[model samples]
Target: MNTTPGTRWDVIVVGAGAGGMSTAIFAARNGARVLVIDAAPEEGGALHLATGQLSAAGTRLQRSKGIEDTPESHLADIVRISKDTADRELVWLAVSNAAATIDWLLDDLAMPVLPEHPVRGQNHEHYSQDRYYWGPDLGRSILAAVRAPFRELIDSGAVTARFGTEVVGLVQDPEAQGGRVTGVVTADGEEHHGTNVVLATGGYNADPALFEKMNGVPAYADASYRFARGAGHRLGVDAGGYTRNHDLYLCSFGSVLEHDDFPAPVLCRPVHWPEMRMPWEIYVNVEGRRFVAEDEPSVDVREHALLRQTDLRRYIVFDGRMLREAPPMIPGWSADDVRAHAGRHPMFHVADDLRTLAASAGIDPDNLVATVEEYNANRDGEDPLGRRFRPLPLAEAPFYAIRVQGMSITSTAGLAVDAGLRVVRPDGTAVPGLYALGELLGSGAFMGNSFCGGMLATPAMTFGRLLGTGILSW
Candidate 1:
């Protein structure tokens, strides 16, 4: 059975992602009469593709593991990690409610986290507290955990979900302040009226043009959910709510692409984490000059260095001996597999000499040879970049180079919202019935110019819980 086209609802959620599902679930449980519409064929938006990491302080699991943590500590760590660039009000709101969100998943929903979860940090910078958490299956595990409860609400006729349907526009009441968004317009030319509209539509990373427009860089890697195409951004901005934090855009460290394109599929992710595997390779830009120290501990420092490079590209140079002697650069593949990929793939180049290798990999050959010479000269002495781990110099034949591109899979710019999550104007007046959450609020709103561990997924659900529980009213 379909919901009547013009029927009124207490809350109309635009995208059925983590945030949207949470809002619909809680609102329906609270007897709010919710409607969830998504462009995907089923629910679970970015969670289907995200890392599924969650960070919260002071959870029951933490206490059980003798981990003493608090929301204040979490907030302080985020502030410190993000360099005080994150939206303080929004970050505070998420951290304060994050523990409850995690508890609801663990205790109420029985979602299983890793046995040694609540780790200090993983790939990114370390948080002061052991608050980062994720499941065995990553994001999919969280998707499975939320699906059952949300489906129950749908089955009980409390919440209605319309999948594979896109929200084309927002219905605004011209007579109200800031043209109050009263409902949403679907692609089928139907208007679903509601008291409040929540724009949980993910981000614009999948849309290359939009991503570049917002981030000042091309979407180099095709690693985001395909349906996140800025529908919410359009709806919110059209409804008079402006987007913010575009200036806070930051790229990921680096990943090898399958092909040379504006937005290419990610072929493989090299393990650049020094803590996990010490680097036996040197990273250089297209100009064949070393930018950041290869042993740079901070992921943020390496990522920002890549951001400064032309086309956000880096070339990881090493030798055959390093492939066999050092830990596998990629998690699983071994020395033989690395040799197979070198000449076969465009991103990977192998040659007998540095000049020839640089030519194949599109790096400056003269600069490459000179850079290697300088690097090898400093092998027994102090390094120029202050690199601590200088195990071996690049003297072996069959030299290799892996070209990696730095890119962000999440949007940095998002629609502006006030304390209540209501989409607001520049003057600070709320668009009466409009609310925005999830990636539509942008990653920068929570993580700022840096990638704070689990900030995206955790805050998304926390905001949804906050919005659905006693925030929206008929």
Candidate 2:
């Protein structure tokens, strides 16, 4: 099922995701023959599952909304969120190009943001203005918009898309002077040569074993792109690029995964922590004790606390009152849906008593019972430790508990690159003809220490645009 047989090109992009497509488009449009290859049957990598939140400063959208922002402000926000651990120059590059790149995506690429969007902030945090936006299906909208342009390129023979093809290794011309990569070898032993190769393959979150090896934390997440096995990293390192940012592995909480597969579906979504879903429910750590404010205002605050816990596992304890009074906490689930899965949802372990519920949920029976009793007693504001956020207590129950684990959808650790998006070796020599975009460069590189706005999608697009139109030109 080769889309283009025996086709050589000026540039070969090793993915069909956002960054890969952007590179191919710009390269082809600039009179360079480009070949796009991907392991997926179609375009769009993690974009299909992404929330598509992006933050940009000094854009037309910001001006329209009467919001004051600049590239400096954007850089400040990214640095603050990353606690100054982010690379200053790289962050500047991504932030500076955000507005223009986004504009290009919306105009030429047909990207549309969410309707009530450009919100100051939503799931992540306040970005200082109404610049955040995503389409109805989030990442899917961005993917759809970009796909048509690439299709035109494919039809014109300027871009060759080879889907269901894996790059087993990179091809280097040692005798061709200065060790420049010539092309890549696909899994089926096909060598498609090109002048430049762009590695847009995503992160390694889907491969737990590899992720755990890179980052010290165990890969408890079940929500990353399956094909993001760090194939690009191996090829990059094999060709002399150095990997960095393996220290900043982060996780998200409030998910009740039923099993251990990567990218596992949420069996029960807890809206209690971020107050996105009200804290009509209380959370207990594996020790059967309340660890957080329950209804914390900042997602970072909650995520930080969850990271300290064992294996990122926690249980949600809610009473009949919350079940009846609060809005359906889980996104996409109605109260009726909760009722239908009353005894069936694996996380929805219910019992007549606190001890019984603890046993069913694999929690310490006595510790859980004491924790509940203590919480109930403190409902009157008698305690001083500042543990209860609502002080509503969990007394009125057909006591129910659900087990949840913290997981991630993108790679946080990656190779360290210069502001020019060049892959640098250990001795600090820039590897010519080698460039990395998207998750292969690592999520922490752009978004910093946290998911600051839409750093993942935005940086990939921004860099791809920068390289396609400028870097690869000379």
What is the overall TM-score of model 1 with all chains considered together?
0.98
How many steric overlaps does candidate 2 have?
6
C-alpha displacement of 114 in model 1, angstroms? 0.7
Report the Cα RMSD per candidate. 1.5, 2.5
Per-residue C-alpha lDDT of model 2 across residues 232-328, encoded as one tens digit per residue: 8888898888788877777776577776554466565556545455576778888898788776777877877888887788888877766777777
Q: For each candidate, what is the lDDT?
A: 0.90, 0.77
Off by over 4 Å in 2: 1-8, 175-178, 260-263, 273-275, 334-336, 339-343, 382-391, 471-474
lDDT tens per residue, model 1, 1-474: 124855789999999999999988988887898999999999999999888989999999999999999999999998998899999999999998999999999989988899989899997889998998999989998999999999988898899999999999988889876587778888988888899899999999889999989988888889999999999998888988899999998888889899987689988899998888899999989999999999989988988888889988899999978888998888778889889988999998999999999999999999999999999999888889888898999999999999988888889999999878989888888888989999899989999999999988888899898888865332
Candidate 1 residue pairs that clash: none
